[model samples]
Target: MKRKNILLGAFALLLVLGFGSCQKSDLPLDGTVSKERIAALQSNLKKALHDTTQGWVMMVQGLNANVRTAMPVLLKFDTLTGDVTTRTLFSKDKQSSKFVLSASTGVPLLSFSTFSYISQTYTAANTAITDFFFKVLDVTADSITIQPFRKGNIYQSEGGAIMKLFRASSDKMKWALDLLNAPGNTGNIFTQTSLFGRDLEVRLKASFATDSIRSRTGFYSWGGSLNVVKSNTPITRTYPTLNPIVIEFYTTFPIPANAVPLDVNTVVGDGLIYWQPTTALTPADYFLNGPNATINFLKTDYLLIKSMTANSVEVYAVDASGNVCITGRIGD
Candidate 1:
């Protein structure tokens, strides 16, 4: 009778221990989601949208057209297991986009686009263009505010005239710099002379337009003397002092209107030229201009030529010269 009792007691103890283990296993391991994490996720998403490179593509396909003009849209986060379950937001175009971000890397894995138009002007000149800026504004245990930088015109041009003036001066300086072969001397007489002459023309036009306006019968007209004294300033340009080893090449590529020419030394040290033939030649075909040379086609990171005609091939690369670096043809 005692043995039976002992066996029964041991069995009951085992069963109780197993039940307790199972209950503990079923409980949440990391506990409930915290408010701080939600806030971080929101801020990170905003920053990513704002920090994209120029020419980045945004896909908009399915939202109402008027929604594209709205300011900032709020971010909604769903949290599970201390990670963001999903992020939903609308853009200025009132079209909704969804992002799935990993909590660990903060990198978005998948992005969806809704029909919307981007209202902010991204192609504006002479100003930093930021489409979006987001940061975690505030966080609570259950909610967060993803602060968005939206619809800002902080550096907007004062007027069209001002914008024109800015562009003109910028162009004049750029031309002068290019003429000098991007020399380092800031006080070159030729550059200064050219700049002065250009500036004078710009100023004269501005002044004439400003002073000549007259209102006759509620209509504006120019009433000042049409004849004006012309300045006899001599036009001259001096070449920039160049380093001995710097090589310069003239090409048809248009320089950015606002770009300041770099000194020759700065370009040569970091520059390499890629030379690709205009014609498509197979591995067995010898390069017409280059002796005993054929192209070794590489499919790796090398640039791909789309079509090869008798005279030219269409090619592109990450850099300007990537197409020029190939030396071998396809077979040999």
Candidate 2:
């Protein structure tokens, strides 16, 4: 009788253990639901960036310390790959780069592996800042709202520096390009003057000057044709296409009164040199070289329009590293 009782007890314990094992295996506690959600969000993000008829624009503030509230950036995402192209006042040309889409701690985030035009400026300005990853907070048909991932950066700890991406059309894209390209008072090629007459005053803020001149200094202008002036020496370059505008000193002509000669020789001028618009080159490349290439103003990669009028314009130059190398006013 005792042996039979022991056998029954052993069988009952085995059955209980089997049931417990089965229950654990069948429990709904796996991360399947969260994983599905993350996948769905990633798909949605890819579609949002690439499926639309046009690109997207985001007004990013807090990226630069010197500027105002924000700067606008345009981005186009590739439909077939993780490639991205960006247009900004940071450069005269468009930038092509790639980004990464990653899932972290049950959230989807986007980051740039290569330095896009926008990232170049942002990271260059803030040395301690590294990540450009934006946490996907929300998305809509026309907009995506994102905040920087909490990675011990300014946007994460200080908070409220959220970036908003909005849909942009083809026409909007063209307009943005045009705005960044325009460099003269007229802001177009057709409006360049025959001679940058005495009316052609320059407010130079070149890299070497003691202080940026507020008052417009008188200068002369002639089209591509060479014209000798009595006292004022205007930078002689092809107007409406000031591509090869020369900043060399003219022994025959003196610089405007109280005006410092705008030369690469005087400053650490290895960047963008200022020039007005021209017909042959709507957006032209300019070089500021000193005697025998001793000084090279090769750092200027950007021309930004600050303000404009019928006869007057305000502009500045920024290098690839987000340094505003020069700012000046032009006009009557």
Candidate 3:
């Protein structure tokens, strides 16, 4: 009887152990985010926007290098009226429009629901254009980071100047249409860049539209030594225009205008020429033009500038893996 009791007790203990092991380690306590919790978050976001005085200041980078450079924009949100007052370097007057906050796949989106100056503008081809919804990526005390988002999370990656916003203060707002118009104040001519320790020529036009091709010759921010004369022989571009081609993947999504006004470089050291084409052509001597003047081929390059002053700008050009491919100065 004692032996039988010992075996039964051991089996019972085994059963207890098995049941304890099966008790589902409590599923990691990531915390169950209920519907109420999401609503609370959305409400808090709106509160932050409404509490600000000067609203928000953002240097908005447009859809696929449209502005020739990042354009400063101000958005003053009135949550009570579901309205947002918008301003930009492109327009002097404040334009009011409707805005809505909603959630998609657990992420909140701030969308311009009506025509606003920042959203609605004249295209380079002189047609109507609109900049659509923004995904609220993060919110801090003084700033908000947003991503230009299309429906279904397409091209949903975060990048460029449009990603950040600062609560605009009286002291921080320092841009106007007139301030951007003066070329001597807006940008400096940068003609010398380096790649692989070799210096390259790069002269920026006072205005790409009216200048002769020779005046704007030399290489792009992403070029190499000699790299050959940036143009092939027998080519000439008397008048040039930076054209913005639409990325067709954004179906049903409102896109920004393809307008690069003559004085679009509001910031001195921040311009990326993703797609630029002259009226005719420039120097006639490059086998690989990256993407600047190439026809139909799509390879992207940018001008990463820093430490800009009245005389010089530290130019940076990176390779595919983010390694510094080109480094030098373009200054007096």
Candidate 4:
């Protein structure tokens, strides 16, 4: 009789514990309805990504820079056959590899299932384009948006890495590349314009190293063309009575417009390139050309790219903390 009573007591305790485990909050648990809706959404996105018949253009935040520095890449996905083709702004090689679409963590996650250049973008010691295990945010007939899915990832807020993929045409990809490399587009000068479109004289913020912003009338210049040369005296300056100083800056190296020419000394030493006041900022020949140009600058936290215009583009420089240190608008 006692054994029976003890058994009944144990069963009652188990029931109470099970009931207490489900402490409800504001979450809706209509159960089947919610689960079905999620499943349907996942199914729709899967179909869109897998059916990349015409290829897709993906716009993601520059791995080492900000959204303003975003670029597009071409992608072709085939989960059924388990392979993907991808291209980036820096490399033209069409990397192919096995990929997977899964719900292993309760949400749709897409990742390269093998070792390939596509995965290298994320795993590479230099670039941080972590789209490997992309968490699907939204999907439509022609486009899908995604963000990196690092478990306990803390860098998302500091660096905006959200990406969007759209159905792409061949012409669009060509245009993106052309805009980045248009002749004289990057090396052109940028200055603040007044209300009447007059060039405003930029005054540099006073510093312990220098006094008076007028120390240099031309605050910015683009390098990188062997064709047109930097003047013997690129900048003519005016200084205050406390510190009257005259300085001339010039360069002969093939410094690209979208880059700062750095001598070997600079690269191995401080590795910081201040865009405004220097001669031959960084040597262009020292590095490879094309999309790699941007990657090289990213190593030092300096991003110079042609603006998205036929006659104009902007140059932006950032500090180690990912904040904009200086900006100039170059125009023809």
**How many residue pairs collide in each prediction?**
17, 17, 7, 12
Candidate 2, 116-167: lDDT as tens digits: 6545433322222234677776678877887655434455453235666877
Estimate, for each residue in 1-332, the C-alpha lDDT of model 4 and write its tens digit: 99999999999999999999987787666666546666876898778877656667765343433223344567788867877876543333456777787664455777777865445445422334554687776788667876667622465442225666776644435454343233442331222212113222322221222332221121232345322222211111100011101112113223345543322211100111211122332334322121233233332222344343443334554332224444554333
Clashes of 3: 7
lDDT value for candidate 2? Answer: 0.49
Model 2, position 130, has a per-residue lDDT of 34
lDDT (Cα atoms) of all candidates against the true structure: 0.23, 0.49, 0.43, 0.44
Off by over 4 Å in 3: 1-8, 20-32, 62-68, 117-131, 151-162, 170-332
Position 104, candidate 1: lDDT: 26
Q: Candidate 1: deviation at residue 24, Å?
A: 3.8
After aligning candidate 3 to the native by TM-score, how far in Å is the CA of 318 from where it should be? 20
Stretches of model 4 off by over 4 angstroms after superposition: 1-35, 63-67, 124-128, 151-160, 170-332
Name the best candidate (by lDDT).
Answer: 2
Worst 10 residues of 1 by lDDT: 229-238
Q: What is the per-residue lDDT of model 3 for residues 1-332, given as tens digits with 9 covering 90 to 100?
A: 99999999999999999998886676545646645565766777787789887788765432343223344567889999999988643323456789999886466788888855434331111111223567676777777776655322236443222466776664444442223222332322332233212222233332213431111112233335222222211011101111222111111112235522111111112232233332222331222232233212111223445345544545543322223434445444
lDDT of 4 at 271: 12
lDDT of 1 by residue, 206-317 (tens): 1112332111001011124111100110000000121111112111123345533211111001111121221222221211222111111111122223223332223322
What overall lDDT, based on C-alpha atoms, would model 1 receive against the true structure?
0.23
